[model samples]
Target: MISDKEKPEGTPKILPLCYKVAEHENIIWVCDGAANVGQIGHQIGVLLTNMDKARMCCTTAVAAGSKPHLDIAARSKKNIVIDGCGNRCASKVLENAAVKIGYSIDISKYLQKVPTLDIYQADVKRIAEIVVKEAHL
Candidate 1:
């Protein structure tokens, strides 16, 4: 183990392991796409996770037919899907895998979809709060 001096000043934040905590945690799967709305969706997931409201899992792992991830999605207390646009790629991935979606939102509906990945913290906070209310997290 490292010495105390090697550690950071603040307490380390240890989020629940998605796979291990699936039965008790709300699992978030976001479409980390290439646009502003997509980027915001990703940030929303991070915000919720950091707030201990949910655990963000890898959407790609489920899409790639990873048994562990698929099981996590199915076993989660709530599977919250966040898609950046109308395409709903993230939702479709879970649907295709037969995982039930507890709640889902299309970020494009709330924010204009832009080409750039840069997003505003205000937007992220707004959307994340909406998610907390809607998903009952």
Candidate 2:
């Protein structure tokens, strides 16, 4: 099992980068629960200046109907789906809405190469960076 130690300190306390960027531009962060605890959320949160401007959604198969998820899918431009594993729950959520994914990141593929990296803070950061870089964020 992945150790909780691998996660960044105050993981649940951090935010997502997308949110941070959104805030800087007076936009919002539309995130899915697939990034529940890690650098992905932190990177995204750094972009959030206000809670009302940032939105969090459940990408899980069951929580797909949540308002946050629906709101995100309905309005997001160039949707980005960050999946914690190969299940690709977030991607499916957007696809179901007939929303095309402009970019995607699968953490499971990274973990396979860097087995020692914790899925928490550092791993999340690395993945988020890659996603942002790839997406030109």
Candidate 3:
């Protein structure tokens, strides 16, 4: 099952996500998710970042006590937390880390039925769109 030519395995790498506060469009996006949201929050954040609307940061790194990640978030001009549902785990993480959220959106509001942590691709896009619209970002 193993081969010498195969790449070695270890902890997954976390690239440095820090950036100048003003260089970004004044929005720091934290892609956080709960068990009931299965990285959907993260996906939306990525979309927003790809659109050049905001800068995406790691939720896992910050939650796991990465100072660099937390520092970047705390110092952002506007820290935006996108939660996948009503649980608000992402918002809590930012709050506990002493980062204030200038704007936030819960994806559950966009759905008529309660969903598991896993989300649909269409829903992800819709959520990100609404965030951009509602937040005036």
Candidate 4:
């Protein structure tokens, strides 16, 4: 069994998508900000890729001026933008580019009335399911 600290040696860690990207490779997907505000978006990104149901384009890729990544995103037939907080960095990227996002999920909305910055596994899964439903995938 793989411990939390160990990944199969040859396994390619998920690329942060900062460089080149395959042409129109993934269909249904997300472009996460992957920021450290609360890690909610990062957790959602891991779940998004791990489930094998969708793809993720990192905000870093767009920020770094990767045309292929931007092209892929702009042409994507479907996309779910998940923002970690009201700052809306990830969503703003799509909007700025005029990329039509099919859906948007903001992690801050899931916060309790008191509003804490912490999020748990269950919260991530719940948000993922919500995205899956919204995207109809």
The best candidate in terms of TM-score:
1
TM-score of 4: 0.69
Candidate of highest lDDT: 1
Better of 2 and 3 by TM-score: 3
RMSD of 2: 8.3
Clashes of each: 0, 19, 2, 0
In candidate 2, what are the lDDT values of residues 1-137, reduced to their tens digit?
Answer: 11122446565544454333432332222333333432344344343222323334344421456654455555554455566556666566667766656667766677653323233556555655565567655
Residues 114-133, candidate 3: write the lDDT tens digits.
Answer: 44566677766766677777
**Reference-based lDDT, each prediction:** 0.90, 0.47, 0.66, 0.60
Cα error, residue 5 of model 4, in Å, equals: 17
Candidate 4 regions with alpha-carbon error over 4 angstroms? 1-38, 112-118
Quickly count the clashes in candidate 2. 19
Alpha-carbon runs more than 4 Å astray in model 1: 1-12
Best of the two (3, 4) by TM-score: 3
Clashes of 3: 2
Query: What local lDDT score does residue 113 receive in model 3, on the 0 to 100 scale?
Result: 32
TM-score of each: 0.91, 0.51, 0.71, 0.69
What range of 10 consecutive residues in model 2 has the weakest lDDT sum? 22-31
- How many clashing residue pairs, candidate 1? 0
* Candidate 4 C-alpha lDDT tens digits along 29-88: 334433433476677666666565556666666656677767877766566677777777
- The order of the candidates by TM-score, greatest first, is 1, 3, 4, 2
Task: Indicate the residue-level lDDT of 127 in model 3.
Answer: 68
